[model samples]
Target: MNLIFIDSIWFTFMLLPFLIFIARIADVTLDTLRIVFITKGNKIIAPILGFFQILIWLVAITRIMKDLDNITYYLAYAGGFATGNYIGLILEEKFALGIQMIRIVTQKDASSLISNLYEKGLHSTSVEAKSNQGKVHVIYLIVQRKMIQNIISLTNQYNPNAFYSIEDIRSVDVQSERINTKQKKYRHVGSEK
Candidate 1:
């Protein structure tokens, strides 16, 4: 007697929007986590994220397929995608993974800070550049997330009025070379003997 195959409870259709919304949240969250894992070079977690991401995507698509005639289902599907992107970005910001290059510029020369950073086993490069005020010294360093605060503090201590910015670095190799300064320290992997 019933043309619609979905039985049990017709009222269950009412919950479709809520379910879709949650699915969207999960899908986006999965994507964000995947990116974070990849950026951090987490081989194990990346695969796990990919598995969950595709799984949620399939469930969302299946719901849409079953209720092709329902307009609310369509809305939920679209809304989920949009919300997922926003959620993914928010999650990425919360978890700052990956190598980052920090460029610190100060109105005054920060030779002391540079020396301190070198002693701490960090690589750096410095150059003279002109800012809105006058000539300033700019120091660049590529470091991991955990060392970000320490670098920032050194920047502040060296030059309070310095302008600085941090950005993600896609790749770097152990053999990479840097310009030499008196404070620079070279690391030896093993004994020369």
Candidate 2:
């Protein structure tokens, strides 16, 4: 019985490092999500994610403190954090939980592109501007991040030479009619009450 007890204890010690590694991964992933949500002005969900992140972090830290002599545990914790950051970024991309403003400048006539955007349910404002080259049309569009690809595809189809820039939007006080319609289809991350 004594020998069996000693073996069990040894086994548990051997397993501790992996367990700590997993916990660190979980906490850091939550930390990444929480920070992203905070930046996006998601008041409702950011705090919730932060709470869980800290909780998991505490658990992992406690294990590390208990096993101060184990170099493996330290390595596992650091490795998990690095891996978690990559995983978190991938998850954020998959979620695409925010809005972006896209600016398109093109020398080509923008009427056709604007009409195409409208037809596709994307609202945009076009202004005639003069650049060093010549007269250009600047088109501004605010859209969900998930729809960026669609907008890009449309732009490429309409005017492949159009210069475009995309910026992350923290909050939009007023949304266009088209955005309102699209908002009904997908839940915006921070828009929840």
Candidate 3:
């Protein structure tokens, strides 16, 4: 009886870490998918993913409770968790689910390029600043990820030597409702000009 109890106890302890590790990994992976889905404008899929993620985590935890002495299991569990998080983030990035802000730093005058972008139905802001190499005109635009190629083409045309940067913009809210109308008119007027 003593040996049986000892064995059971040892088993439970050893496996606890592994169980927790696996459960966390599953949970985080699901969260990563959920965020991606939300960003992609898919309202239905994210919740479904959350449901399965929680269910898997519950099962994993229950198994860990039954065996506590499995040290190797515990270590493996933790390792699996770290690996899962990395995998989840990579998978999410591969999906690329949202709008991005593109910033262009040009070594020369880029007002014409900015004017062209606005003419093409994109909103842009341009400012003149001094850099290490001297004065530069920086242009900022917030565009959908798919529009980046077009923007890049414009940048190459206007400022081949211009430096540029792009970053993901998770959410946006335009405070001025009139801005859209103004942008549309700006495009139409530029075309006619």
Please report the candidate that would top lDDT against the real structure: 2
Error of 3 at 20 (Å): 9.3
- The residue pairs found clashing in candidate 2 are none
Model 1 lDDT at residue 40: 67
Candidate 1: segments with Cα more than 4 A from true spot: 1-10, 36-44, 115-123, 127-135, 146-161, 173-193
The estimated TM-scores of all candidates read 0.66, 0.87, 0.56
Worst 10 residues of 1 by lDDT: 182-191
The lDDT of each candidate is: 0.73, 0.81, 0.71
User: For model 1, how does the per-residue alpha-carbon lDDT over 1-193 read when each residue is reduced to its tens digit?
Assistant: 4545436345445576669878977887788789778876788998998999889989988988877887877787788878888888877766656667889988776788777776666779889888788888888987665467767776777787778899877666746655222122432222121
Candidate 1 C-alpha error for residue 157, in Å: 6.3
Q: By descending lDDT, how would the candidates be arranged?
A: 2, 1, 3
Model 1 residue 104 CA deviation (Å) reads: 1.9
For model 2, the superposed segments whose C-alpha errors exceed 4 Å read: 1-14, 174-193
Put down candidate 3 lDDT per residue, 1-193, tens digits, no spaces. Answer: 4667646755456545555676778777887788777766777998899888879777766765565765665676667677778989987766555677889999878878877886777777789999888999888887666567767877888888878899877666666432222223333322453
